[model samples]
Target chain A: AQRVTQPEKLLSVFKGAPVELKCNYSYSGSPELFWYVQYSRQRLQLLLRHISRESIKGFTADLNKGETSFHLKKPFAQEEDSAMYYCALRASGAGSYQLTFGKGTKLSVIP
Target chain B: DTAVSQTPKYLVTQMGNDKSIKCEQNLGHDTMYWYKQDSKKFLKIMFSYNNKELIINETVPNRFSPKSPDKAHLNLHINSLELGDSAVYFCASSPMVGGGGGDMDTQYFGPGTRLTVL
Candidate 1:
């Protein structure tokens, strides 16, 4: 059974403060993780993927295989960054095509 | 232009009625998918089509049917809808998996259709 868990349903942070949205997954194969964001009244969009190893909009997430985690982090939180974030995982072997998404975390960067 | 788009951003209807939500993608991607997001904000994949072929089908009710006439279009039709079906339905697309690094495949989502069953 593959599952993605985002423990925090709501995370509030002050502007310029550091932010970390935790995510964990349960899977038996290699993991391809991603962080997606949905801003207010906007469509859900891709923020970043672990495989890209790149930062998007000052947010970065690293795939921790040992911990089975892919936590999204940002040194400085911006008000515009407040949105619903989802952590997803994809299997590597035979079932690598479909994505399993977490319940999602709502990050509120209060000014 | 939007890569993925869905019609009827807001739909309000009664139970026992049938409805259809249309989706189209202009990214020329080979894979398209339908997802359901409940009020609790839990998103789950309902169906997936790649190059006009059904590749992934989650445990969805028979009343919820998806139709994809081509690689660029995938529509969902619900028959005798129930109140429990009220939720946000999202359509997404992505390039074919595997080939140029499967991990690089990123799905682009539509604005989503909010179905309100009364």
Candidate 2:
């Protein structure tokens, strides 16, 4: 079965500190990975995707096939960056349009 | 303008009652989906529709039904709602590229409907 694991329920870091939110996946075939974020009182939105390999909102995630991970990282954390982040995977096969999402990790940037 | 919207931003109802949540997308996407977020904030896909056709249905209970009257609308109806059904439901839509079953498209989500069953 394909699954996305976010491991950390909450991650706290001081402002200007580096931040890393761990994400791992279990899948046999190639998977399309994505990071979605939901800020307080804001709707959920796409942050980035492995296919695009683009950084968004100062956050970058590199797909590590060897480790089967796509951890989200930022050089410096900001108070405004605090939000709920979710790792999702879409398997490559028929009837695989649906995304399997992780439990999500809440990042709290302490001022 | 709202790209994707869901009706009844908050719903508080008694158990055993039936209710419906409606979703609409003006982005002209070919696919729409329903996701449930539990109290723990764990999100899971419940159903998906492509161009008014059912494409994916997860292990949701039969009491829950998803209806796509058209490509731009998808509605979820729950029968005899249980206390366990209390959660935030989100509606999302994505454009299908290359007609490849919308595998690699970016999904836009609505504000979400918080359902509270007592």
Candidate 3:
């Protein structure tokens, strides 16, 4: 069974501090991983995907196949960065549109 | 303009009633999906349609049915709604995989519809 796990239900950090939200996945084949963010009163949006390998909003996530992890990280946390983060994994194959998502982690960047 | 939109941002009703949630996407994508977010905020895919054809269907209850009249519209209907159905439903669309050069992995989500079963 394919599953995504976000162990931290809530992660609090002071402004300007480094931030990391852990994400791990269990899949038999190669997976396309993504990070999605939902801010207060805003619709859920895509933050970034491992395939793109591009940083968004100063946050970066590296896919570690050996560790089966794709932890999102930021050098300096900002108040605006506070939101619910979800880690999703898509199996790489034909006709697979389902995104297996982890229970989201709420990040609170306190000023 | 909203890329993806869902009707009735919030729905509150008694259990055992029937209801429907409509979703539409103007992004011209070839694939659309429905996801349910539980109270714990665990998002799970319920169904997916590609070019108006059902492509993926998870282990959702048979009481829940998804209809896609076209590629841009996908609607979900629930019969005899139960308390367990109280949650947020999100509609999303993405470019078709193996269709072209665009990023098919990135999905655009609609404002969720929060359903409360009293």
Candidate 4:
């Protein structure tokens, strides 16, 4: 069984400060990692995927195969960045439609 | 326009009561999913349907059943709800399930329906 772990349940960062949300996964085969963000009273939306390797809204994440982690990073946190961030993993090939998600990290950007 | 949407923004029912939640996707995607977010904010997939066919069924209890009338709709029905079943249910859809690349697994989610079992 694949499991995703988000070490920080709640993370506080001052506005303009760098923010890092840690995520680690336990899987045997290769897996696809994704970062999803849910704003206040908003639906969950895809932020970025490790496979895309594209930065969105000044946020980027790199897949670390060695550490079995994919941490979301932002150079400067903004008030709009305060939301619930969830790290998700999808197994490759068959039954890959199912996404196993982390408990999620609540990011609080203090002004 | 709303890409994915679920009916009954909030549901409050007593234990042992039966309830149903409906979901629809206007994105014309082929795959739809049902996920439950518990009180601790732990999101887990309960069911997945592609073209009205059952594909991914998690270890969820039999009390939870998903019905897909067509490619764009997937409804979830709970036979006997329990307090533990109180959670936010989200509906999502993706263009394709398995293949690789080109937004293969990029999912569009609904606003979610909060179910509270008293």
Model 3 pairs in collision: none
The CAPRI quality class of candidate 2 comes to: medium
Query: In model 3, which runs have C-alpha deviations exceeding 4 angstroms?
Result: B98-102
Q: After superposition, how far is residue B37 of candidate 3 from its true place, in Å?
A: 0.5
Predicted chain A of candidate 3: TM-score: 0.98
Give iRMSD, candidate 2. 3.0
lDDT of 3 by residue, A1-111 (tens): 799999999999999999999999999988889999999878889999888889899999999999999999999999999999999888887655678889999999999
> Where is the poorest 10-residue window by lDDT in model 4 chain A?
A90-99
Whichever of 1 and 2 has more DockQ, that candidate is 1
Chain A of candidate 1: what's the TM-score?
0.97
i-RMS for every candidate (Å) is 1.9, 3.0, 2.4, 1.3
lDDT of 1 at B114: 98
Writing each residue's lDDT as its tens digit, candidate 2 over A1-111 gives 899999999999999999999999999998888999999978899999887888898999999999999999999999999999999988876667778899999999999
Candidate closer to the true structure by TM-score (higher is better), 1 or 3: 1
Comparing only chain B with the true structure, the TM-scores of all models are 0.95, 0.93, 0.95, 0.97
Model 3 lDDT, residue B46, Cα: 95
Q: Which tens-of-lDDT digit does each residue in B1-118 have in candidate 3?
A: 8589999899999999999999999999999999999998888899999899988898999999999998899999999999999999999999885332228667899999999999
* Model 1 Cα lDDT, one tens digit per residue, A1-111: 789999999999999999999999999877788898999888888899888899899999999999999999999999999999999887776546788999999999999
lDDT per residue for candidate 4 within A1-111, as digits (tens), equals: 899999999999999999999999999999999999999889999999988999999999999999999999999999999999999998997767788999999999999
Quality class of the docking in candidate 1, CAPRI style = medium
